[model samples]
Target: MATPRTRGAARAAAALAAGVLAVSLTACGGDDDGGDEDKSGGTGGTGTTVTLPRLDGESLEVAAVWTGTEQANFKKVLAEFEKRTGAKVTFVPAQDPIINFLGSKIAGGAPPDVAMLPQPGAIKQAVERNWAKPLGAGAQAELAKNYSPGWQDIGKVDGKQYGVYYKAANKSLIWYNTQVFENAGAAEPKTWDELLTTARTVYDSGVTPFSVGGADGWTLTDWFENVYLSQAGPEKYDQLAKHEIKWTDPSVKEALTTLAEIWGKKDYVAGGASGALQTEFPASVTQTFTGGDQPKAGMVYEGDFVQVNIGETKAKVGTDAKVFPFPAVGDAPPVVSGGDAAVILRDSEAAQALATFLASPDAARVQAKLGGYLSPNKSVPDSAYPNEVQREMAKALIDAGDDFRFDMSDQAPQAFGGTPGKGEWKALQDFLKNPEDVAGTQAKLEADAAAAYGN
Candidate 1:
């Protein structure tokens, strides 16, 4: 299960370390130099020099959906921000489709100063609603020094900067149980057909081939996005992401049909369709690695962050558990990615200062050092990653530069892509329950997308 690393554009990687991208957050106008430059904020792990403005009595609130270990690790980063600027920042736990949560908070006039938007659509929504404030010049300078053009573009809407993507995830890997594969004599698959063959082999060896987290609709979106991107190519993927093409396109049907080749086989999934619908994301991952050779499932597909859950099991990565790129459906494997962007919801001197801090390598490095985190900032040194796997994964993302695709569903409007129990989430959940209805599924998708996109 040793996945071959795709060599990124060397020229692109070189350019990544050279450019300065734009960010928008107003500096709080605090100009008290705290001793030496290094003490206040010299290199601070970020290769570029960043001098943060002091905010002695400034207090700000930041909101995101991160919980558990993810929340704890992020808190450490906030602590560093506090130490450097003397700003008291509180972490607010918001629910998924954070726009909905923020809508109520904004209406209540108690919105956090900043929010981490999980999708481009949500960021766009924030801007459309006039809830998001553009970043200031100081924040833009740090972004230019630390981020590449592609990363910077993700946060820009209507030709204006609105967010800084601090955390990134590679969503095209499939982690599997080494013992199960070894026992089944199954080789890692490189193409879609080969994947089916491998699944059959594993099933004949008395174990399920896949562990699907159907309960969490976002997982289903990831499944379709990877398949659609690889099968239909990036052009159509982008068209669908922007809703420029209907979801009922022949291309969509083709991808769904191909997906059904696996979903149609109940024997291939850990708990069958019904059971999978009841399985949450965490359990789907734990099931693959918990029982050794006789685990409930042989493989689980997710982003690089899957390593965090693997840490909870008796299995060890690189040995008991290993990964491969999602099998190719077209000429090459799909390189789809997702991330969280820091957006200013209520502009303030403290709010803007924090945005600038996040854009700096100094902030990214703190989270990168902790296991299960990846940063898109090129200035983050390879040594920041805790292991070789993470370093390779992070390099792949930075190296890909502008050639890779962002998550498909994340690009669509929130009503069609991100909401829980409604829109695309529920539509796909229904599809997962009855994958046989490709036409019906496509129709539902098209209808929902039309409403969301106002087509």
Candidate 2:
């Protein structure tokens, strides 16, 4: 799950790992004068006793699938929120397999007040099963104006809003070692032909051109989606998501062909890199730059969040590691992958207040301070960004407008996120395992989609 960012500039690294780690309260700079009363009704004002209700009187239970470093960041945000609202947040961090745990809980009728889902499909499924509620009128209006149009659309299952996005990173970029490109006398590519030439040049320089990890069964799908964008453009991609078009379309076939061409290049990727199938997504990304000290691979195609995962690596941002938008293949429009919204579940006073605050430009600034994330609020100024890279990325996002889209896998039905699902990841894995059966694989996907839509 790589979040999308604006292109053309490097952003300051905000430690988002802790933000996604778990839900807990972190102390913030605020007075704890319980006896100090404010006289401005429920609102805090001088001489009035303003006491905000805590999130959970005894314990606020929150469930999420963000583990490892990401879970840690999530706890930090919760901790800060609890301090501000005097709530006790109990965090339940789970593995990537969140659906199973959540399914049982929803069935048991003991659902958490707030659940942080990585994919939009999970939220949709929850809504379908009545395990979740829509943000309703107020939340919808406020969030609609705060986030990007694409982010807002992700939370919509049918025509109702059910989620709000808090933290997001963009994925339509390629990360390369700046020094490697400079040493190889190669420039950042702006077109598919240029990219291929650059990759070939790098490969001929006695280094693995790309450090992609296809072993995980999903990493290779990144290439597929980007290729599709290059071939069919963003408009067709959207139709595909809504089941308006079949997966066996010529655009899809061309994308797959392009991927096969890249993968066909021997030594283009690290030897034994396919072993990454056994490794997790984060670990596989780390493997790309892990051996750069010995120059195993020079570049990797991933989202901006990879910067947060590759800790202790000598790859410094803008120096050792830099990102560029995936070059256009033919006449296709640019498409990037970003996270969905983080919907508010509880309509408590605190939840309402928090929601209102988050919808404000001020709150967007606060979020940037907490973790240099792209704010959906259009009102926030680019100068407010802490780092040059972030500022540039934010600018790109604003300019991208309707061209940006959510990750197809995340936008698809929940079943698509699973192993047996009909998604780009599963499709790529099947294609790679049996290249000769590409058409059969595409046919199976089309059949599944048709069945799901009852067409």
Candidate 3:
């Protein structure tokens, strides 16, 4: 799913109207000597420390939207930072439309030192408004050494770096119950035709083939995006993302019609369309993983975030629950990804130090070992991941380089791509309810998109 973020000056003005104030960190610089450390790849030991110059004990406020398992894992990373630099790191959760909170803070002149943003659009807005400080030379060098040029580009606004992409989630994956597939004698699909055939095989074995999460509209968007990228290719994907062509363009219809092939067969989806419409994304994963039911689905398609939901179920990843790249609909599988970007809001030696740490392999290793987090840093080894599948997924995404794209919805404004109850979500929900009405769905998509882009 594309993580949602807000934009526009009107939104900033509205946030300031609400009188929400952001509290800044009070810890000042100290003379403590954090051992002189290098900015290269290392495990930060007595001989090799992860330290930034002149930032030994300054307090820094960091912000992001991570919660639950993600939050817990990040704390481990922060703990490592505290050990390395002796700087106090406080995590402040950015509320919905972080633009609002950021706007209020900027207007009040109390922004955090570093804000970990989730949207490229927000990064662009922050850079344009001069609310973000570009990554320091140390941080940029780390990024240049550890991350691919594509990952680095997401942080750039007009070819100048304003942020560092730390964590990435590959969205082009379909998680399935190994037992269910094995019992049905259905191997993992390699192509769209193979996937349809596998769906039929699973359906024939007295089970629904897919746990469609129609209620959580972003899941639906991911479904459409994976197919769109594979069928229409990445160039058109880029064009569609920028709204250079209308959403009513034939590429969208081709994707939807392909979706209808499986969706029109109501029996293939657990609880049919109505149940799917009521099912949330987490529940969809649970339904697929928790089998031995009357009408349970076999697979749930989503990003690695679903792994957190899977932790709540009885299934184990790699052993019981397995995933494959969404079977290619065209020449090759689509490698869709999404992640958080760390941007400096307060220009300071301490803030720049923190940015340098976040951009390094040392910081990424802390979270990678805990699972559900994939770092774009190439220096982080594959063995650091929790499972081979996840390791391969992250490696494939990194290796995909120029071939990969951020979630399309994330690239668009929230109203057009990321909103829950309106825009693409609602329009796609309508299509799920009636898959055969491709033209009608296309019309709504164009109208909402046009309104969203003001085209």
Q: Would you list the C-alpha lDDT of every candidate in the order shown? A: 0.81, 0.59, 0.75
Off by over 4 Å in 3: 1-50, 53-57, 95-97, 104-110, 292-295
lDDT of 3 by residue, 1-455 (tens): 12121122113212221211110011111211123332344553212234566456588888887777788878788877777777888988876456567888889988888998877877877886889988889899888888888899999989999889988887777877777888889887768999999999888887889998998788898999989977887677889988899878989989999999877886887789998999987789888877543338888889877777777787767666767767778755776788889999999888888788888888887777666778888887666665554555556555555446688877766667766678888999888889999999999988988887778
Clashing pairs in 1: 20-144, 21-144, 23-140, 24-135, 24-136, 25-135, 25-136, 28-349
Q: 256-329, model 1: which lDDT tens digit per residue? A: 88888888887888888889889988899999999779999999989888878887788766667778777778
Q: For model 3, state the Cα shift of residue 138 in Å.
A: 2.1
Superposed by TM-score, candidate 1 places the C-alpha of residue 339 at a distance from the truth, in angstroms, of: 0.7
> How well is each residue in 110-146 modelled by candidate 2, as lDDT tens digits?
7666676767777877787676666645556666666
Worst lDDT window (10 residues) for model 1? 20-29
- For model 1 the local lDDT of residue 40 reads 21
**Residue 162 lDDT, candidate 1, scale 0-100:** 97
TM-score of each: 0.90, 0.79, 0.83
Q: What is the lDDT of residue 6 in candidate 2?
A: 27
- TM-score order of candidates, best first? 1, 3, 2
Per-residue lDDT value at 328 in model 1:
76
Better of 1 and 2 by TM-score: 1
